[model samples]
Each structure stands twice: as structure tokens, then as C-alpha cells.
Target: MSFPQLLTLLVIALHITGIVVATHAVMHTRTPQGAFAWALGLALLPYVTLLPYLYLGRSHFSGYITLHRSHRQRLSQASEGSELAGLPPSCTRYGALARMLQGTFHPGQQLRLLIDGEATFEAIFDAIAQAERCVLMQFFIFHDDELGRRMQKALLERAAAGVQVLVLFDGIGSHALPRHYVERLRQGGVAIHPFATQRHHNRFQLNFRNHRKIVVVDGWLGFLGGLNVGDEYLGLKPPLAPWRDTHLQMSGPAVMDLQRSFAVDWHWVTGELPPMLPPRPAQGDAYTLIAATGPADPQESCSLYFTVAINAACKRLWLTTPYFVPDQAVMSALRLAVMRGVDVRVLIPSRADHHAVFLASTLHAHDAIEAGIRIYRYQPGFVHQKVILVDDDTASVGSMNLDNRSFRLNFEIGALNVDRAFAADVERMLLDDFGKAVEITGDEYRRARYPRRLAMNVARLFDPIL
Candidate 1:
């Protein structure tokens, strides 16, 4: 065939391939809405959807079009291994979620909530500086400011001293970082990789940004919480009012799970795979379960986790998120939990990063109040933390907001502690924040300004895409 005929044939083949792949993905996904969305995109933007799948789809048999297959394999391996290996002795009789997580990382896990941003930073930075072997980090925004530079300097020193170091930063999130930031680390022998580069504008790639903020060193120490690698996360300087956040510094067998996550993301950024976290004896008095959910599997795992946990709640459920635009499942579950007398309470930012989310959260919350679920809006500083305290024995903390973006698009890692003491501590911290918040009632809900109601409804319509 001539050039024109050849090109036409290629286009036809690619379009057919796109439909098959989209159909296969939707079938594997199982969610009707997700299937419709994927199929719709494939039908409308055939090339855009097809090209991304060839590279980023979950199929291993996709051949040259198989994108991130190695990374996906590493994720599956790490998730499965850590989930089964980390169960603490005290957690021998725990639930399925705990079991699955325990089968992955350390079972005996105790986590302390560091609420103050500065205090959280001190805990994390000290741990980073003390890392004896490799420091694995993946952050959404590694700003180019004072805190970012300070971290870069320390990471460089450690890497130069032959400490194994790998860092992953999101391309879009960390776009403002100095152009030479990665180069600076490269020159110091520290490897750095940007997740989802500009050349790959894969729709899901853009949607599934790594919102996880993780720090793991020597496979013995790991930090997960709200604070990103920035001055603002530390609350030293706030872009909008004073910043408030939380973090957890964990050492014990559970650290291995966090370490595993770091290693996988590190490998994705750099071509070289990092060492697996060797199993260790359980530490601490509490049973801890480490769980991660993301696009790597084409499953919205965090949202599913939330549903599972919420459904399992029989007594009480309390959630705090800076962003509160929850997915349909989450909303229904919370409402149902309340209807079942679970005493559901959701704490959201009285003032947050986006008016749309904040307002939509209020609307959902209005219904929650009517259903006997208490809702509070924190009016002090911005609550940049995300945490869920369920009943008397479990608490989950991580980078996930309750918003749709976190549940449907971005990657999130949450730590579930089965220790009563730790869970109580988290509950108390949440209660403390709740005390500083203003509770909303039906009367208050009815009194919302017309403009505000309009804005919130508009926001609700966009929640699916948030």
C-alpha cells in the first residue's frame, strides 16, 4: 500500500484496539459508572484513550504499549508481601481488613499523632537526617523554598556520603521547584525522578497524581502524615492563614510496609529497584495495619477501604478531612452508618483550599445532620490533616482527603492502628479539633445564603470529576 493507505490502515487498527482495551478495562473495573466513563472517552477521543492504554493500561500482555508494567508488578508484589508479613502477635484475632494489611506489613503497630505542623516536621526531618542507609521519599509538592532547599541540602549530603537515596516528586505538583532542583541532587549522586512527565498527558496520569507523602529510611523508620516536603506543611509559613496538619513517625515492623511503598515509587521514578524491606520482629503494643490504594491497579482502593471500614462501624465513626467532597459510596455509607446509630461525625475545614469543596462538603453535611450525623466546621487555622477515627480500636491517617479527587483520581496511603491507646489518642485529637469547631444544625443549614447554596450545588455536580 502507498503512504496514505498505510496511514489509514494504522488509524483503523488503533481505533479497534482502543475499543477492545477500553472494554477489557471496564470489565475488570466492575464499576458501572467507571465503565461508562472509560467507554465514553474511548468512543469520543479514540486516539487519546487508546494511546494512553497501550502504555499505562493494567494489561501485562499489552507488549510495547504496556506502560509501567514493571512498576505495577512491583506494587502487586510489595502490597501482597507486606500485607501478609507485618501482622503483630496481638492482632492474631483481628478483622479481615486488618488481616489483609497484617499479611503485608508489621502487625504490631503503634502510631502517635503529631498535630502541630512544626512538631510533625521536627519528627520527620530528624528521622530523615538520621537515616543510616537509604532515604526513600515521594511527595506531591517538594517546593523550592527554604524548607525544600534545606531538605535538598541534607539529602545531597547523605547521598554524597554514599547513602542510598531516591526521591520522587510529582511533575505538576512540584512544577514550581527550581529547574535545577533535581540536577542539584543528581550532581550529589542522589537519584530523582518526576512522576508523570509532561510528554505523557495521559488523562488518568494527570488524574492519578501521587498525593502520598512518604518518608522511609533503612526499612526501619517511616513517616506518613499530612506534612508534605514544604515549609507550608511545616506551618512555618502559610499561603492561606496559619497551617495546621498532622504526621505519624513509626518505627517497628509496620515501618516495613511504608518502606515497601517508598521503594516501589522510587523504582518507578528511577530505573533501579531498591532493596526490599527485610522482615523484622514486631514492635510496639498496638496491632497496626498498613494499606495503600491507587491507580496502579486500576482500582480505587482507598474509597473501597473507606466503604468497608464505614460499613463495619457499629458504634461510632468520626472523620476529619481538609477537603470533604466524598464519593457517592462514602456519602451513602456515612449516612447509613448514622442511620444505624453509629454516631457519625465529619469534621471539615471551616475555611479550606477551595470554596467549591468546602461548600459541597457543607451541603452533604446538612443532610448528615438531618440523619443524626454530627458535622463540625473548624474555624481556627486551616485543617490540612486527613484522619478517620472509627470506634474504640481503629484509626486511619494519611494524605487522602474525603474529596472525590482523592478517592477517584490520586493515590493515597493510610495507616490503620488496631491499638486502643493509639486509636484513643487519635480520637482525642479529633475531639479536640471538634471542640474548636462550630457544629452545624438544620436551622443553620436552612439559613445558608442563596449565593452560597448556588455555589455548593454547582460544586456537587462536579464532585464526580473532582
Candidate 2:
């Protein structure tokens, strides 16, 4: 065929392909806004939008949903007779959430609040050093920096001591992580793998990230929260230094739940279950449960988790997150909390590790303030902790950010504790953080220069996948 004829045929094929993709987007996209946006782009600009749609458009993960269900069923049967007699009265407040997640609040959990990277790492390292049987560790970002190397050393030592050590990190988040780093761990007898989301039929899907940070030692001790393994997380690197974060250390039956989460992810990656240890007896007085949510869930569990927590608040609801891009349901829950006379406060970072997300968060913060919700910017440094305090008896600390990515796209986990003492510790820590933060009015976004305001509005358009 002549060149002109060939060009015409190719153009027609492209348009047809675009229409087919647009149909898929309309049918499969989670939100109406997202579906509309994808459909419009795919139909109008096939050349530019086709590849991106394939990579990021799908809202559901392929094999994980089936794997998650079967695994959960197996785990449930395995622990049938070991469950606590009943939920504690304090935990009944989150009963709805528990039922939704098909999990129960495990009592007798001993929780320790680890503030900032130093304390978190010290405790994690100490636990690893004492590991007698196995260690299961996972992080979204596993940098090969000072702290990462330190973690590598600790895991290597444990592995050398004949302890089963397994590690998982996100492929995208740690794309820059050196191969030698992983090679050294593997060579040292550690079982390490990347949580590669693009597997089998999901090869084109790269948007779903495993953002959970969890560590389980000997099936008795567990650790999880916002901090990742990186020098910047340790506040050793600058520009956005003095990093602020929170982690939770726990013992008792709850640790088994955390370990279960790690096992599910491990099974997804390696197609085999990791070693499971018998549940230990109660270690303390706290009642806690691990909420693991992701795109594969039948419902948007992460968003619902926040929404339920917000709605349950009667007296006060304070939340801290590095990113503040909450979904409509969560935002609506916050507004309702305000209308119900709940003291609703949100803490975010003043620093911008991600410019687009920060701008979007600023706009959201403005909107929140207008609704009688208080927004504070942590002044000391980037406050990366994801925490929630409800009334005086419930608190949560975990890797789930208050953003669309965490709410609907990423695999995230958090430990919710129903205990006044643990909540008090979180409350005091937040009180100190609030002291260092400055509250912002809606005026901050309203009074911004037109260009900046326009950028923020533009950023808001990407909130679904942000």
C-alpha cells in the first residue's frame, strides 16, 4: 500500500483501539469522575492516553482478590479455636469496622509507641537481634542508604544465626535500590523478594503499590507504621530532614494478625506461605487489630476505615498524615464530625516532599477549614506519621496515608488499638506535635497567587490516582 493509505489505516486502528479502552475505563473505573476523565482522554487522544490507561486506569487487582479471600479463609480456620472469647466493650465501638474486615479486635496486646525514626529502628533492630526462629519484614521503600544498610546488617546477622529471615519491598518504591544490596542479603541466607504488582495478567498494571510496613519476629513481636528503611527517614539526610514518623511495637495475639498480613503478601509474591508460628498468650491489656486494605478488597476498606473512625468520634477526632488528600467519603465523614460538634483536627507537613500532592493537600486543607475542621502544618519537619485518635479510648498508627492512593490504590495496613492508655500516649504525642504546628485558615489557599491557586486546582484533578 502507498504511505498515505498505510497512515490512514493506522489512524483508524488507533481510534478504534481508543474507543475499546474507553469502554473498559467506563465499566471498570472505581469513581464516576475517574471513569469520565479516562473515557474522555481515551476517546479524544488515543495516541497519548492508550498506554497510560493500560498502566494506571484499572481499579482492581487481578489475582490478589482471589488469593486474599482463600488465604483469609484458611487463616480463619487455622485460628478458629484460638480466638478471644469476645470483643472487649471498648472495642465494640469499632465493631462495624471489624465485621467489614472479617477480623476481630485481639485483646491482651502490649503496644509501645515509637516516635520518630530513631526509636523505631532501635526497637526493630533490637527485636531482630533477639529473633530465635524467624523474621518477616516488609516495607514500601527500602533504600540502600545508611539505615537500609543497618537493617541489612541486622537481618544478615540473624540469618547467619540460622533464623529464617524474609524481606519484601515494593518494586516501584525501591526502583533505585541497588541490586548489590539485595544480592548481599540473598547471599547471606535471607529470603528477599520485591512485591512486584505487575505479574501474570496484571503486567500492564503498575499503579497498585504495597505501601505496608510490617515486621514480625518469632511470631510473638510485631512492628508497623509510617517509617520506611531509609537514611532520609532517619533524618540523616537534609532538604526535608529531621523526618518525623511513628511506629508501633506490639506483643501478644495481635502479632499473629500482623504476621498473617505479611504471609498473605509473601504468598502473593512467592506462591508459598512463609513459616507461621503458634499464637502466643496475652502479653498486656490493650485490644488491637490489624487493618490490611488494598485495591483487591471487595470494598474500599482503607477509605471506610477512616470514615468509620471519623463517624465514631463523639468528642474529638485528630488525624496526622504526610499527605492530606482524603477521598469524598472521608471528607464527608470529617464534615459530619464537625457538624456533630466533634473537635476535628488534621495535621499535615509544611514541607513538600511531593509538590503536586502538597498543593492538592493545601487546597483540601483550605476546604476542610471552611467546614470548621482545623488544619495544622507541622513546623519542625515533615510529619510523616499516619495516626488517628478518636475520643479518648481509640488510636491507630500505621502506613495508611489519608489520601486517595492509600484509600483505594495501595496495599496499606494499620494497627487500631482500643485502649485508653495507648490512646493517651498517642494523644500526648500529638499534643506535642500540635504545639509545634501552626493552624491554617482557608485564607491560605484563597489568598494564594493566581498561578499557585491554578496549579493546586490542576493538582486536584489528579486526586483519584494521587
After TM-score superposition, what is the CA distance of residue 426 in candidate 2 from its true location, in Å? 0.7
lDDT of each: 0.71, 0.90
Off by over 4 Å in 1: 1-105, 197-205, 237-239, 277-280
Candidate 1 lDDT by residue in tens digits, 289-374:
67766655445567877887788777888888887777778878888897788978888777757777777777877777777878
Cα miss at 20, model 2 (Å)?
A: 2.4
- Stretches off by above 4 angstroms in model 2 are 1-14, 75-85, 201-204
Q: Per-residue lDDT tens digits of candidate 2, residues 96-206? A: 787667787888988999999999999999999999999999999998888889999999999999999999999888889999999999999999999966565356767
Clashes of 2: 0
TM-score of each: 0.81, 0.95
Candidate 1 residue 390 C-alpha distance from true site, Å:
1.5
